[model samples]
Target: DAGVTQSPTHLIKTRGQQVTLRCSPISGHKSVSWYQQVLGQGPQFIFQYYEKEERGRGNFPDRFSARQFPNYSSELNVNALLLGDSALYLCASSPLGGTRTGELFFGEGSRLTVL
Candidate 1:
């Protein structure tokens, strides 16, 4: 089976423009989480969704949002983007109900650049 995958591989946008990133989970998984990885920094959790319901959220601005579909695919939407928002958006997936280790598999991520 294939692992998690994300689209656009790279993205470039001017400040104030919005962007939408997409993700497909690994086979047979249900939980999806979104994270932001700034240069030289670890990814910070943005949101987590399971069964189309919001499971968890991190300390991010309201401009950051996401949702998981019934089929487990997910999309992350960022509004009123800023230069500070430029970062790698990673999508991760794990089995249903999650594991004690939170062993989530990650995608290469969509790299966003704001000018």
Candidate 2:
């Protein structure tokens, strides 16, 4: 019955370091997506996985990657991080094949600060 869960609520890293954020989808959900939200701006979609397969990807650079497990949990990895990459990493989950209502449930998100 949980909505969604993300780990390491916060993180701080230096430029060029790599980081990985994790997420667990809601019960009965089979699709998970990642987003990046910079302060004062709307979230930007990063990646989406359904049934453990990559369904979609946004305009992010090659440094961003993600994968979904069989259990519907997912992880977002960023390589060669830059200060520009500092932002809130959000995880969202929806029903498999999506919902007609076009609603997505999101988690508290992981805040990453790159220096």
Candidate 3:
């Protein structure tokens, strides 16, 4: 089975440019979540979508948004990207959500660089 894959492994953008990152989850999975990893910090949850519905959201600004598709893939879109938004956008997957101790399978991530 194919593991999660993300596009544009590295991206460079100006402070105001918008950016879109893509992710394809492992086969036979349905839940997709997004995390932002800043330098020297643990991944912070951004959003979690299950069965194409928004299950949970994190402490992210409106500029951060994401969606999951019927094929279990996902995309994260950030508008008005700021210099502080420069981080590793990680896409993770789980069979389902609401697990007390579930682990996430992460993609290599789309590294965003802002100038």
Window of ten residues with lowest summed lDDT in model 1? 94-103
Candidate 1 error regions (>4 Å): 98-101
Which lDDT values do the candidates have, in the order given? 0.91, 0.91, 0.89
Clash count, predicted structure 2 = 0
lDDT of 3 by residue, 14-98 (tens): 9899999999988877888999999999999999988888888999999988888888789999999899999999999988667
Candidate order by lDDT, decreasing, is 2, 1, 3
Off-target runs (Cα >4 Å) in candidate 2 are 98-101
Candidate 3 clashes between residue pairs 3 or more apart in a chain or in different chains: none
State the weakest 10-residue window (summed lDDT) of model 3.
Answer: 94-103
Candidate 3 lDDT for residue 74 = 90
lDDT of candidate 2 over 30-69, digit per residue (tens): 8998999999999999988989998889999999999999
Clashing pairs in 1: none
Cα RMSD to the true fold for all candidates: 1.3, 1.6, 1.2
